[model samples]
Target: MSRLIQDAYTLAKERYAGLGVDTDQALATLDQISLSLHCWQGDDVAGFENPDAELSGGIAATGNYSGKARNADELRRDLDLAYRLIPGTHRLNLHAIYAETGDQKIVRNELQPEHFASWIDWAKANHHGLDFNPTCFSHPLSASGFTLSSPDPAIRQFWIDHCIGCRQIGASFGRALDTPCVTNIWIPDGFKDTPADRAAPRRRLKESLDQILAVPIDRQYNLDAVESKLFGLGAESYTAGSHEFYLGYTASRNDVLLCLDAGHFHPTEMISDKISAALLFVPAVVLHISRPVRWDSDHVVTLTDEVQAILHEIIAGGNLDRVHIGLDFFDASINRIAAWVIGARNVMRAALLALLEPTDRLRSFETAGDYTARLAFQEELKGMPWAAVWDQFCVQQEVPIGIRFLDEVKQYETRELSKRA
Candidate 1:
């Protein structure tokens, strides 16, 4: 056996010993281990997968919204669809609103008490099996230009009111769903150019976060503060920037946690070690998994071999369980469903690789009391190409290749086009 395979065998033996399993059971367990079962959904997948398709497309296509009904169904069908796509065992990150203007901004006009209530009902019915995270508001109003720093209080209050309104909506959703509605706060609130005032904008964000947490809600919600490096307000200028700034800001606040985006960290710094360390402080409630190419961060769920190794090492060192995995992709060109399916596949492979580490090896590294273990682990992973591992595992499990999945999506698109014709 190769070193990696030997390591896997050793870990299996240890697990079997803990379970008091005989050699026969250990071998059987090893044989049954597959790589397609370890992934979870990120909210961005819904938006990225189908820009035109409402959240309902990812959830279910069976509901309707008539003109200004007081009781709107925010996500009943979508929630059902989300439930179907992800088994109850996995976490589902639901986007509250797609970041858009005019007709696309569904939350501004339609997400009323009745719609909120329907979401709550759907969540409560399905909570026993599935874990749900209702990411807080994301729309033009929620962005930097529209928040507390705005010259007009009405505009700022509109943002605040939206937060307050969403809290009420979230409370209903959580009550009906029986799961905590995670407050995902990602503000494109920084200056596009050199800020006329740097500290002021950050202070505004802090105030907003503090105010939101103070509101009375039924269940405990985590404020997942997303860190990005891109300086500025508009989507075009906002590049994924430094996470340390966001992490430092939220760490002091109660009920607040960091929502680490893998690609976001790639631009500012090498994230593996920094991320490992961050987990030591704040609880990471959610993860945005993607790869960064050049300066632009592509939401391709494709993992480089080095990244897979680092992620595995981080998990083996004990950060995996703290956060829910989100298969985040935001590419406009790719088919959204294909992105979700393919991204989920890559995430599963990453998880299996992480889980395959031997407990003793992990413990020994932890006991060493030095940070060098991260480096050593990276060295161990140096020779192993994750692409090869992914390919081999796909073949072994009889799962479709990424290219095949993409082609399937293309065919679906073609059929849809024909129907339109």
Candidate 2:
């Protein structure tokens, strides 16, 4: 480690000590939190099977960034590069569409664990835990923006079968790695124009989900989750699987999780408040951390106020262990590797910042009705030398500090990513 970084950390540690915060404990807690890196970012949500397929269901990658992975090998290579730049071990979240079928045209319903055998092998080799998602978008069946909620029984059955298969695959992944794989199901079932029969579609969706969950897999290997969206590309008027619907569904069930995407709610509604509320009823919670500009744009996550607030609530609520953290954003405008590094590092940074706070002191002040002292201490804590501690963490992790990681990314682009053409 550099002498300057070491000296800065010592001073910062002393400052935090005065606030009744233990720097070492904070760092240890930060190290234990693993943010699952989304695999779709490297390829702009364009999976390996079909290159010509266009993104649908409000899913879009804006930039025509160069160096996108053409195949699974290339994608894994880029992910390894990004993973190296990131500190600590993490999990990789994958969609079912990313499966390698080779010459076979295996339908989603017919998908088997063998299709993801390569991913399991790769994850095992790299010490990375894996998470799974059922891709209900960017497919022909979903072009209508309805999958599980379709009025046609055949169409609904097809999607139900696909989700059932995805759950088994998730269980296989968890069993292979000995860690529970969160199998999340997100569908683009909604209407661009307001529907007169919203009730019908929601009823069908409930039936479809009931059938999907009929086949129970062991929870030891896999946990089921349903994701909700406010609105999207074609489905702007109404989303069948709205937050209320999923919240109610999760509350009724014991095995499922309610996924709260930051970008999936109204602009004014912050998910930081919802975390505690949802966990109160549901068995647990799953988070898809992303930044939304005006809507559900799925922009790359930054260490914004909302992000910090979300982490703070999770820690303060004492539900960190019950909540699963995953990143869900795709930005094709910049270096994909850099996007991963920046987002993952920001999450870690936010966790560290939250950890460094004297939560007990603030809570005690609030309980004692000292609002003035509580507000002052909270505002003043922001000025602490948190950055120095973060930099020191980078030094300890043996990863690049600050802007240095970007230099390494540029080098990789020249020697590796540029040659994709």
Candidate 3:
């Protein structure tokens, strides 16, 4: 209840009301949209299963900022702080490699719901939802640079079983938490150099996907999703699961969702423009929001033009209800907790900006062939007092009202993260 915050919010509310916009309604809408924060950011994608395992899926987390979480407990502790810094209640996205097996030797294929019992319990206790992903990379089984689509039947079977187990775990999360968990499958099955034949591998990918999804989990418990990529670190030749592949697969089966990752496309191509067209055919989509510089770098997300456009498409296209939004960036170059806070907060800001827009008025102007006014209104929205309302939101959510949250993170760093070194 700082005087400055209150005065700014009151002025912002008045300014928005003049544009036929209800700031209150916008904040309400923003509150309802929950973000699924990725767990990998806490530990630079090095899970508890084997802290030494290298990221093999053309995936990498740059930087060696001290205090990377070494185990599930530490990671959860870090995540607790991060969620508290964020404004809304959000879910945690876990990878198969993060399983806590204590001193036992367990492989991906043999993973069970019991292994993730602690996570389920944590989610329940904290009122947070949980999501799952199968670790198809960073294993001896994937040393050949192919998985699921590998011509070797044994490797394909291994990955298939792993995915089946992950889906079941996702269902367990949903059943336990009463929130349908989205189990998404993304693989690094491709050749570093151009391959002689591409058709055979893709056929194998489709078949493997079918076998993995054969059993029907109650949509109420878990939903299936497939992610695609144009290229990868070693898979520059061709990514088996290209955008077209998953788009067609998910479209063919309404049961599965198509995952459109922001950093998975060409530098010039944007996922924002594809959301509208993809939703026309696919029932729903899982959005893995990220920032890419020249390639799929998986940089921290910011309130850039592309990010804003992505949010606008979701808010304006009326696709908000069908899209599952999750962040997908890992920057180990800075404080891990700060990385999470920056990416998540920037995304929420973009979404809040989108929510505050006068979309109806802009649409009507466009429909009436009033291009000049449409563009003018769109430009004017850029200068609106949205940040004031956002500050108010952070205040209401009881999180940090400004960069003051960073002070808390640094305190934690000095009190805890610094000791890890």
Sorted by TM-score (best first), the order is 3, 2, 1
Runs off by more than 4 Å, candidate 3: none
RMSD of each: 8.6, 0.9, 0.8
Please provide TM-scores, in order, for all candidate models, with all chains considered together. 0.65, 0.99, 0.99
- Please report, in order, the local distance difference test score of every candidate based on alpha carbons: 0.46, 0.92, 0.92
| Alpha-carbon deviation at 164 in model 2, angstroms | 0.1
Query: Model 1, stretches more than 4 Å misplaced?
Result: 1-88, 98-110, 116-146, 218-228, 232-245, 266-268, 306-310, 362-421
Residue by residue across 197-292, what tens digits does model 1's lDDT show?
555555665566566667766545323344444433243333222365567765665455676656554364555556667676776645566666
Error of 2 at 118 (Å): 1.3
lDDT of 1: 0.46
Residue 239 Cα positional deviation in candidate 2, in Å, after optimal superposition: 0.9
Considering TM-score, which of the candidate structures 1 and 2 is the better prediction for this target?
2
Count residue pairs with overlapping backbones in model 3.
0
Task: In model 2, state the lDDT of residue 419.
Answer: 90
